[model samples]
Target chain A: MGSRLPTGWRDVQVAARAVRLVLTRPAYATAAVVAAWASLTVFVLSGNIAMVRNLVVSGPLSPGDRLVLVREQYPFLGTNYGTLEGVAVLAVAALAGANLALVAYHLREHELSASEGGGSLVGVVLGVVGAGCAACGSALLVGVASLLGVSGLLLRFPFGGLELSALAVLALVVSTYWIAHGLRGGEVGGCPVDVGGRR
Target chain B: MKQTSRSDRERTAGVDDGRPARRGGREPEGGSRSRRRLLLALGGVSTIAVAGCLGNGGGEADGDEDAGSEGGNEDGGGEGADGETLESHPVGVDLAEKPRLGPDPFDAPATLVVLDDPSCPRCAAYHQGTVAELRESHVAAGELSIVYRPYPVVYDWGERAAHALEATVERDPEAFWPLLGYYFDEQSSFTSDTVLERTASWLTAETDLDAAGIVADAREETFADRIETTLEAGSAAGAGGVTPVSYTFVDGVFQSPINGSASTTAIETALQL
Candidate 1:
């Protein structure tokens, strides 16, 4: 506890410490991994549920074949991971995992309310929409914009709406920092307070 | 000893007492100020991002308008009495021999030409949603015909899928729809490396067509020229790299070009149905 540390640096340290503490627990670590996998799956298959349904209902495919298929199709958001857009998707998935893990930690330890995790929830939603498509545009955003007869407007995004994914990344970072600050300051669900300014 | 409630203890200790501190009491001044700053920063970033998107869109729109005006000037002397140049009008393509669904193109009141890439998810969506509805209502009623042009714009797998489609169409025309439907339905399960082999296996198991010969034809690139012709046709229509670009023709005259996933209502309006 460097009392004289700058506020921003202290906030980062606290958040990092809180994340480390939560992930050190096997249960929370598993939850984080599972949540990250689930979030990535949702991001990839959001607009393509029929493909999954077909694979499941159709004739049996070998495990190796299925794995290859997933690998090939995993970059549905764009061409491949070589591009900035594809990297953004991976970033979103990772940040989403960490944010959710922290939220879960707070809920379990501090009895955090659903409303308190609203930021994390919004981050997840934005991640999904932002990771839609780097080339053509976000499928969900396009659908919504099509209703307003402005779907063409999405074409104007400099990175083809990769900015939205960037926004999601920023949002998760902020949420992570906020939760960490709460944990460090003992401001969340009732932790023992040190009135004498003692740690 | 004075009885102290949990809240009293929390107040004395400056610690969270298993209750949300942000809610029922005055939040710490530092935390409150930090939160405000974060929110303001987020809002500022969001504003800038939105502005950038709008700025790009507006700039592109203006550029397109400028190009349109330039084209108009170049063709000023060729304008008809209605001030519309022949090039400005949508031209209908001959679909008499194209792979199609519903009534014969010559007999139907309208024909919708669909250019799609098999690996494109939006094309799949358009096929599943808008095309299905049209097939039930207009195609069933013989009011409309639909011609499918396999345009591979997404991945190498799309070209392979297109080749497979061409083979299927040439070998057993009736099996073409089912094969195309299978490709769209299970798009993610196939890649450039595996599409032809997997398609051959699926066709062998599912259809009566000579799947072995079809696969051989695809491997031999028997229909590469035909696919190239379709690709050129799509490019000539200004489709760019977008998939599921639809062209509607009512009474043998091109009405509109719909980009991306066109809705059933949009197709209906385009056809004046």
Candidate 2:
């Protein structure tokens, strides 16, 4: 195989194959992209909030105090990394936007199978719910506590909200994967109906 | 594995011919149509759901330019003894311009006020990461001005640090930023008393400001009202009990409060809006 190909042809060949794959299975590709963007955003937001909460609630640290106080100590100076960082962030947002566009494209094409469509709906619902819960903080725990009438049960579990948020994110990821996988079979729709049988 | 295209299936299922074809290994035409409709309906719901999430994140960008300027009025009564707005708590330090960089801070149309606790690692990450980068790009370019508020809302040393900031700003405004730089650069030192003492001395020797005087000022109640006022101002601007809350002002108008140590990209997007 090596001898049959030119030295620079392999990379070009691989890229061509990737492009072909995307063109052939656009729905799956779109689903993967959308799922990734949504899940990543949710994960990052939850993780950041969780880290801040852990810092405040855990350890010997006071809940409402700060560490440093002076401004001169800030090392305030301009660095040359802004453009690069900005580009990176812009790229992520653009990719997310593209994901949304792909979802619309798939819908417009009428190419979604029932299972694929169902998976996508479930995934999107899970993603929204998860993101909301993560923002609410200990919502699941609060509900459980209220239902069981045992508020003290939560004392031993610090970062309960974070844990629940992480779990919800996991579910979102799983649901997204399911949608992508379900789309992999075909875009013509899930179960074929035997219309000829009625004749 | 099914070779049939969607249109072909639809044509076979019901192409205006009343007699429904019984395609082998497939459900009846009626079932096919219902399933297609169900899938389409599901797609519509998913589209709306995902769109809602995206819209929630984007809608704030379109808020009226004057929406948040009045946010300070909610708790405006907690003014400092000087009677100036708490948002104007920055003193001593000449914010007019950063020497060789950018235009005058006061003249800048947009202000990005960040309430950060030096002791908060999240705040540190933001400064060292997003804030530092922002200063390089927007702040230096005169596109934006940053007002730093040392909010102590997570550690005991945090309050001390806030006091020190007030003292530095009140006594030696020029030294305020420098001292803050030192605090963040050597944040670990503030954890222990001995380390903090050494850091104080180091600051005294490093900068033109007297370290002992700054420490003494922290212990005094001179800047107490200002500190409290600043805290209230942050809360009024939607600090929401979190340190590292930031509010952006465009054309001297309050735009929105950025909770936590958000990314530079996120802040930049907000600025654009």
Candidate 3:
């Protein structure tokens, strides 16, 4: 009963084990992949949703052409910002998928209220708002800023709004840990101490 | 001291087995309430932080909206007098040198000056959607004219495409629109290293233009100055930062600037059509 693990080590272990359990199931794995794909699409198309809609509605581009265009227009891919932005998009997508999967697992296993899944909702909303090209700005970010009465402040970000995406990734990671902690039979309201005498 | 597992303690404490321990179904309310409050505080703080990050602490204090609109008028120099109609605003770019679609500028009831980058996804969408719709509904009907100002804002490949566009405009003005269309159509296939070769080959196969000369001029950056001038003009017109921005002028009076992707309805309303 005297085992002293480092801070956050237990959370990480629990999260890893939970993720393994979730991914091993074919249904959960498929859900994760679908979620990841959807998240990636939203990130890539955040600012261009209207344009893409117009394209589909009245534009002359075929579906295949639209797909190609989207692939090439991924934020910072051909820009001077290097590949870090692309990596950020991928990381956000992956974390968002994992968060959703873990939340789903928690809900299935426990009879918790909807508030228990609030972290997952927060992570998703943050990811969508933060998804955009750091250099050119995403329409979602711009629209949100405009609503907040700060139309042009995104241009002043030193890292070109990458911080928003970073924050979103952090939120998703915490949400994942929270879900994992719950799945490991740890009380969410209490310190995640191992008391099962198993390890 | 006797050792008791967490599960055993929960059982002895009369916690419901079906309910999660965190829910505190029969436990004291303080811990659960505190945790919920903590999560709420964290969420509130994060929301505020996100808003702050995006808003950059300035909000409306910076007067960016007013300044941007003022700057746009000053840049375009197209501010019309009361009840006056002009052919076009003195946006500094030579309108005659640009590729045109539909009626002559003087003959059309409305003019749409488009600033776009070929490599821009939004621009591609605009080209495929609003542009195509307008070409059919307005341009072909002889009610509207479109002036293209290719301004590269996405990547270096866009600049190269601009050069090729200029070369095409120089040699065979009629081929300019198709070449621009081709670039938009196959945008993903061309990279900075491959745009020149691809454009040249496509031109040779698709049209009767001098593909080699166009490719050579693009490689030599023959139209760099022209492209830069158009870029400056677009910047001056307040469409610099974003691609696929359009300026609409109806009956020679500056109507509005459609930033980002211009929908057909917005353009139609601007055109008073």
Which structure among the candidates has the greatest TM-score?
Answer: 3
- Which segments of candidate 1 are over 4 A away from where they belong? A1-199, B1-94
Considering only N, C-alpha and C atoms within 3 Å, which residue pairs clash in candidate 3?
A: A47-A139, A59-B128, A59-B129
Model 1 shows how many backbone clashes?
4
TM-score of each: 0.47, 0.46, 0.53
Cα RMSD (Å) per model? 15.1, 14.7, 11.1
Which regions of candidate 2 deviate over 4 angstroms? A1-32, A41-199, B1-106, B133-143, B192-198, B220-222, B260-273
Which CAPRI level is candidate 1? incorrect
The residue-by-residue lDDT of candidate 2 on B1-273, one tens digit each, is 235455445533421133222233434234455457656767687666544333222222222221233122111111112222224533212333221124444556656667777665546666777778888888777788777767665455767877777777775566766666677787755762543465478667877777787777776745777767656554433332344655555555443454444566556654552
- Listed for every candidate in order, the interface RMSD values in angstroms are 15.7, 14.7, 12.0
> Which residue window of length 10 is worst by lDDT in model 2 chain A?
A66-75
lDDT of 2 at B229: 62
Q: Which stretches of candidate 3 lie over 4 Å from their true place?
A: A1-199, B1-93, B104-108, B237-241, B249-263, B269-272
Query: By lDDT, is 1 or 2 better?
Result: 1
Write candidate 1's Cα lDDT for B232-268 as tens digits. 5554444445466676666655543444554575467
Error of 3 at A49 (Å): 14
